[model samples]
Target chain A: MTIDLFQKTGAFAENKDVARDIRVRDIIPALERHEEVILDFAGVGAATQSFVHALISDLFRQYGNGVLDRVAFRSCSEAVKQIIRIVVDYMQEGMGIDTEDAPEA
Target chain B: MKIHLPNSAFLGNLDSFLRGFDSTHPDHLEITANDQWIAVHPVVLSMIAALGLTVKPGNVRCGPLQARSGHYVVRMGLLKILNIPSSITMVEHEPAGRFIPLTQIRTSSELTSFITEMIPLLHVESEQAKTIGYIVSELVRNVIEHADAEHGAFLCAQYYKKSHSIRIGIADTGVGIKATINKSHEAATDLEAIRLALWPGVTGMTRRDGGTAQNAGAGLFFIKSIASVNRDFFVIYSGSGFYKLLKPSPTRRLRLNADPFGDRHSKRDDLPFWHGTAAGVDITLDQTKEFAVLLEAIGTTYRTALRERKNARYRPPRFL
Candidate 1:
């Protein structure tokens, strides 16, 4: 399953409600069905840490650190990529994942 | 209540103006200004607007301005927003690339729309617009989600052509930081609450390392780090406590601190009581660091802070 992020959050994805909607309404359901979920950030310019956290942090908590393997972030700008890396790294760190397993920032 | 607008009150000298606020009477607001010339930060106006909403329109009393620059506040929409009668009449200039008049955002959708229309007000470059938009979105969302304010958040901004800086201010008359933060952690004073709130991974919602799914407890820390990297000023006032991040000396090398007090800052615990919270930040376009670089610094610092917090609580086998 693929989610067109720009269609949902515009160019700059700062709205947490929209991010939550994408996560609850789409991302979680796809992951539960054992399908890969691709978050397409093709036209997205910038995103807040809160928005990114809302979109994916709970999935890590619910499914553990392995969820990253089933999900893909597509066409992310450098800034958006950095933000996702930040949220993912800290979340894994909070869950006591070893430094070797956490994604690099 | 009485508030005296001094001749000058930017983030640097905003302490005096905050100290001079008389919040004794909860029902009436009396505003007086310097007679010679008046120049103040938008936070000053935001604080007043937030307070004015609490009292009846007839209860707000504004003394006539004798200063030449009193008309400036009129253009900023303070008098009109408060519904206080004013004799000063000035031509309303087009607000494009100048200033954002006083605005009250009460809902999440309102904030999203406000940012879409707000980016063009400063005529900034792409990088600068991202910083401004990010700050506005984070701060306003905090209010809507946690402030419990009936009238919501009041915010405004001004573009300084001379210094190429954008000054933004947001104010809310809610239950204040102490009430919100006390739900999860104990903060003995308002300044302590402010400190805890600014620290990464600390939220009123949970005491867990990373915040809940919806919140990471990082909004204020990121905003402060932006100002810190740029060597700009960021101030937060709630209750009688105020915290201001001072500009570092030009010769000092930049570093992000996990603890707000570890950075160069001034805090007060004895100022006049403000019922809610108000925050103001100054972003200089020329001095702005790249947003990506700033985020990297923030990420590193936040991770280290989280590690140290867990390690502190970790129990090791008895090493005799």
Candidate 2:
């Protein structure tokens, strides 16, 4: 499942409400079906840390380190990629998991 | 009683002006100002008018204060914006002070509009404008999500052309930091509450009202990181606790009885207490400071810290 984040939430995804909508409507359902979800960040100007955290922190906590395998983030700008990395590392630390061996998105 | 306008109408003097209102006898109060060399920002004037509505309502009147050339036009514009009837008749003109009036952020659309309108007035380039817009938006969102302010949030911004810096202030009359953070953690003092709040991933909204995922708690962390990196001024005041970062070294935490702007470099904690939370950001308008570069640097720092921690956790036991 390829989820174009820009198409889903417009170019700038910073609001938590938009993140909640994306998670409930797209990401969670894809994971439930065991589908490999790809978050496409093409044309996205920026994704705030709060938005990324809201979108995927729960998923990471629920599935633990295994989430990296099922979820792939592509076409991310350096800014967006850094934001995702921060969220991933933050959630990983909270769950007492190490990111040294986690698969790259 | 008649009150005279200060030569410079800046926000720093707001509290002093408010103190002049007589609560005992709201009526029979008058405001007068000699327009000669009087310089007032629009934000300050609008805020004063708003305060009038709250403090004395129709009991106050403005007496004739001679307005020099351009001052008359600006004064009329301010009165029009405040929707206050004025005896002075002048053509509508742009006020000297560039400001966004006090607005409520009830929806995301309103927030977006506010950001769009405010960024241009900051008088910075495209990238710098976007960065400041994001910071302002994030801070206001914090007010809506965390502060729980019944009256919502009030924001005011002013760009000091002479100083080459822009100062933004967001205030809320809400549950405050001590009360909110105490919900999720044991914050014994207001200072502790503020400290914990600034830490990444420490949020009072762990269990959201709608059972949604908790807030990332990185809002203030990001704000502080950017401010410190740029050597700008950032201050957060909640409850009785006041925390200020003046860039470089020396961040102070104090308690204030009122909302007087403390010395940016003061390193004390014995002031009075403010009722709610107020966040202020003062950043130099440097074109070279890009938001993406700042975020990348912050990410690298976080990664390095996490890597070190993980390495320590997994290292073999030390030799005897």
Candidate 3:
């Protein structure tokens, strides 16, 4: 399942409500069906960490850390990729799961 | 309540102005201004607007404005939002590339709309717009989701041509930080509540290491990190607790601190009690570090903060 984030979030995706909507309506269903989900950020300008957290933090809680393997972030700008990484790494840290690739401060 | 607008009140000298606020009477507000000139931060206008909203319209009073810059507040829409009849009149012009006047946002969708319209109004570059949008989104959402404010969040911003910085202010009248953080954790004082709120992975919603999916308690941490990297002033006040992140000197090495107190900052737990929260951030456009780099720094601090918090809960084997 390919999710065109720009289509829903415009250039900058900061609305948590919209993020929650996408999560409940699409992402969770695809992951539950054992299908891969692509979050495409080709034209999206930026995304808040809160928005990204609202979108996928629950997946880590429900499906465990394995959800990282199922979700693919495609065509993300460096900024978007870093934000996604922040949310992912911190959630893992809070869960007490070790991550080898965490970046330096 | 009485609030005196001093000659100047930007975040740097905002302490005295905050100290001047009389939050005694809940039914009425008395506003006085410096006779010669009144130049203040956007947060001051937001704070006054937020306060005025709580009072009965007729009960609120503003003495004659002798300041030459009284029209500045008028242009910012302070009088209109509060429904106060103002004697001062000024020609209105295009707001583009200038300012976001006083706006009240109550719902999530309203905030989304405000962000959409605000970027263009400021006429900033794409990268700068991202930072402004992110700040507005996270801050307003925090108020919407947690503050439980009836009047919602009042927001405004001004772009300073001389400094090349965007000054943004947001204020809300709701259950203050102490009440909110106390829901899940034991915050002994409002200052303790502000401290706990700044720490990553700590939320009033739940004490779980990783917050509930909807919230990770990392919003304020990210904001403070952005300002810290840029070496700009960031101020937040709720109840009698106030925290200000002082701009680091240029000669010092740039670093991100998971604990807000670890960063050079000024804190006050004795200020007049504000029923809700008022926050202001100055983003120097030229000094904006690459968004990617800022996030990487934030990632490190946040992850480290969470790990330390998690490890604190671990128990070692006891002696026989």
Candidate 4:
């Protein structure tokens, strides 16, 4: 199956609030149509940790593990990406599983 | 004009006490030795409620009083829960110095300059003076970037010659730190966000254009480091929890103390976060040099940002 990828840059690209909402809107639809989706956050600066948590953890819960089988993010700033990784670890820990054991997407 | 309000239940009595004041007779208004502004949480609520009872119910102007131990305790406690900077903090020696309240970003520069000008008043050195500039600017600039509006934030500072420290505060009417975190992160609870944000390398910056993190997860890191090394003071109040880096208990306040620069040294984080969020900082630096005066220059940078017009727009840009 063909998975659609979406890229955003400029204004909203840098908005933590909007980027979060966009992540939800963009990802959920692709879940229904395709088996995987990759979000590119290149050229984006800083994002509030909350925004990353929403995209990485909250969205996963909304869809369920099996529902969002293949998910990936590309080209986020190191700071932005680090927060995402940390938040994901936090969520995984909350679920009582090693993050490495969890499926990506 | 002394009144005792042990609880909010006494708001009516407090109201009567306030009503007793007449500007024409200022001497009669002086607080007596027994007069204590008991800022109990519930009592403060009641005070606000009582004040709300007024017919016109407009602007309420209160104190620019000398920084007292009590004021430090209550304010720090409150700001901690709210998760914003407390515009006022402990000064080492100066007493009864003038306080200027500047709310708009346009005047941030003047505010910084004003502090820089006050450096000689306290007798700090050039290097320490630069630190004063950096800390104050970082604190104030963050206010402008995040908590200024959604929270109706306001900024004010106090310079005390006797104590040899300057105290400043920035408050807002937006969501508290807890709310901001909750809104920003679906996984993080308000409380968790509070804890995490304080951790070094944890930042609120986003990947949007306006998303630049004013603080690089490093601002607080550096500030805390400086406070520790120099024996300065630092406190952060976000959402409903208070996190402090000071005196014995580094993570949280086991008990509250009010010596802005007490021997034990205490920093309070009672920034009001009733709005979506509000954040403020209260820092006290040794004022033996010109650093504080130079610190004022940072405000000018913030003021310049205000003039850019880009900041006026409420909504973040939509990248279609």
Task: Please provide TM-scores computed only on chain A for all of the candidate models, following their numbering.
Answer: 0.93, 0.89, 0.92, 0.67
Poorly placed runs, candidate 4 (over 4 Å): A1-105, B1-124, B148-152, B160-163, B182-187, B207-215, B248-273, B276-320
Question: Given candidate 3, what's the lDDT at residue B295?
Answer: 85
lDDT of 3 at B305: 77
In candidate 1, what are the lDDT values of residues A1-105, reduced to their tens digit?
999999988878999999899999999999999999999999998999999999999999989889989999999987788799889888888888855354453
| Model 3 spans with C-alpha error above 4 angstroms | A101-105
Better of 1 and 2 by lDDT: 1
lDDT of every predicted structure (CA atoms): 0.91, 0.63, 0.90, 0.39
* Interface RMSD of candidate number 2: 4.2
Give each model a TM-score. 0.98, 0.74, 0.98, 0.39
Candidate 3 lDDT, B1-320, residue by residue in tens: 99988889999988889999999988999989999998989999999999998999998888878899988988999889878778897889999999999999999999999999999999988878888898899999999999999999999999999999999999999998889899999998888899888888888999887788788888998899999998999999999999999999899998788899999899999999999999999999999888888888888888777777767778999999
- Model 3 clashing residue pairs (backbone): none
TM-score of chain B of each: 0.98, 0.66, 0.99, 0.47
Model 4 lDDT tens row, A41-99: 66544333334544556554556444434777677655445445545454443343445
Worst lDDT window (10 residues) for model 4 chain B?
B25-34
Cα deviation of A70 in candidate 1 (Å)? 1.1
Q: Taking the tens digit of each residue's C-alpha lDDT, what string does model 2 give over A34-80?
A: 99999999987677787887788888767776888899999987778
**Evaluated with lDDT, which candidate comes out highest?**
1
lDDT of each residue in B1-320, candidate 1, tens digit only: 99998899999999989988999988999999999999999999999999999999999999988899999888888999999778987788899998998999999999999998888767888888888999999999999999999999999999999998989999999989988999899999999999999998889999988889898889999999889988899999999999999999889898888899999999999999999999999998899878888788888888888888788899989988
lDDT at position B104, candidate 3: 97
Ranking by DockQ: 3, 1, 2, 4
